[model samples]
Target: MKAILIEKPGDESCMKLGETAPPALTPGSVRIRNVACGVNRADLLQRQGFYPPPAGASPILGLECAGRIAEAAADVTSFRAGERVIALLPGGGYAEESVVDAGSVLRLPDALDFETGAGAIETLLTVFLNVFQLGGLPSGGTVLVHGGGSGIGTTTIDLVKRAGGRVVATVGSDEKARRCRELGADAVANYRSEDWVEVAKQATGGRGVDVVLDSIGGSYLDGNLRALAEDGRLVLIGLMGGAKAELPLGALLSRRLSVIGSTLRTRSPSAKAAIVTAFQARFGADFAAGRIRPVIHRVFPLAEAPEAHRMLKASTHFGKVVLRVRDDER
Candidate 1:
């Protein structure tokens, strides 16, 4: 098997591709001949000596992958060998093959190609779980998504709009704002040039939004609070800006607002499986129904995983960047 191994955390140049033994499948786990994998920002942070793979996880960098089941453990009953599936990984997605708990392996919708499936689990799970499950996004609610051109951002825009919510998005430039509008955002604000909270307020007719899905932490944390309506929920998924921030405690109390943080990669297997199951039961039909679809901006071959990481860091892409492990996987 070929894998991208990070001998030590450093710059993007540190990711090295070399031959490695394939991991053997364990009880309740399945071996996947990886067809595709998604490049996540956390992968870059990990390589730069910031984020580390959780305990007991593979040292490799990928967070989600789509592939065929080469072997299914005896303890697994619902899935079998040769099934096309997408699975969430605690780590080790940046390889030719990987293993995952069967409970985390989801059958790919026939309508989806492997590249799309490969990029699905991580961003979609993060958005669905935080925005809807934890953030309490309601049907007919007004929703604001920061970093709207990001993979998770675009996914949130699609899900919220399809669920009957009005979408407002904040982006860095005019180009991303255009993409956000095309993706069903009722309004788009250029966060780099304008005050997004004001734009959000105007878009919502001065009532503010019912929910805010924010990834950039730090100073934006206070702004997120300002953008929310009374009883609004603010879900923080990343602190791309910085970890520490001056929060508006008075506003939080006065408006009865809620702020919750989420990270899918570090969650326990049972927690990941619970979200997989919950999404399967509720939004699975959306995939087949054509309401929610994977949005991939670019696809790079597996060996060029470093380039994929660079692309993600550039923040030029409007949606997900997926690595094509094998063109025939679909």
Candidate 2:
């Protein structure tokens, strides 16, 4: 099999298509002839030696993929050979093939293409688990989501709107603001030129948002805390800004706020499987029903994985940047 390998751990140039042995299907798992793979910021970080794959995970860099099952374990009754599926991986998504626990695989919707399908499951799972289940954003509640034009951001906004929740998003520019609004954000704060705390408060009628989904930590910590309504939930998923931060503990206690930090990649397989099952049971039908759609901005060929990394790092894309492992994966 062919997979992406890193010759060095610093730049996109370190990535290359390399040959490797095929993965064997483990009990309760299935082997996929990968058709497409989703490029994530983590992949770039992995190549730079910042984010290593979890123990016993594939060394190749990729987190999510859509493909057809080529082999299945006898215990895996939900999926079988030749079935179309999408699965999240601890690593090794950028490859010609992948082997994943069957419980973690999603039956691909008939309406979705592999490229976009390859892109959305990870983002969807992250948003669903964090925003709805963890953050407890009510159906009619208001939310403040940072990086509104990002893949995770777009997925978060679309799902919130479809679920009847109001959303306020923060963006880097006017164009990003316009794009976020077009994607169902009720309001957008141009963070580059405006105060997000004020924007969030005003959008939610001066009380503040019921929940805040933030990727930028430290530098934006104060604003995120201030933007939340009383007893609000703040789900911190990334630390793009910095790690250490000084917080107003008095304000947090006074407001009865909850701060939760989370990440998907480092979880146990059983934990990930539980999330996959929960997501399917709760929202699988919506995806098949066309209530939610995968937003794909660009697709690069399998050999161009490095370029895909470059594209994701540029942050110029509004949605997912996927790799086309095979033209006919759909």
User: TM per model?
Assistant: 0.97, 0.97
Candidate 2 lDDT tens digits, 175-276: 988988888899899988999899888888899999899988899999999999999999999888999899889999999999999999888889999998
**lDDT, model 1, position 124:** 81
**Model 1 worst lDDT window (10 residues):** 286-295
lDDT of 1 by residue, 1-330 (tens): 888888888877888888888887888899999999988888888889888888888888899999888988888888888888888998889898999888788887877888988888888888889888998877898889888898988998888887888989998899999888988999999977899999999998898999888878897888888899999998888888889988778998999999888888888889889998888787888875545677899999888888888888888888999988776646
Index of the highest-lDDT prediction: 2
**What lDDT would candidate 1 get against the real structure?**
0.86
lDDT for model 2, please. Answer: 0.88
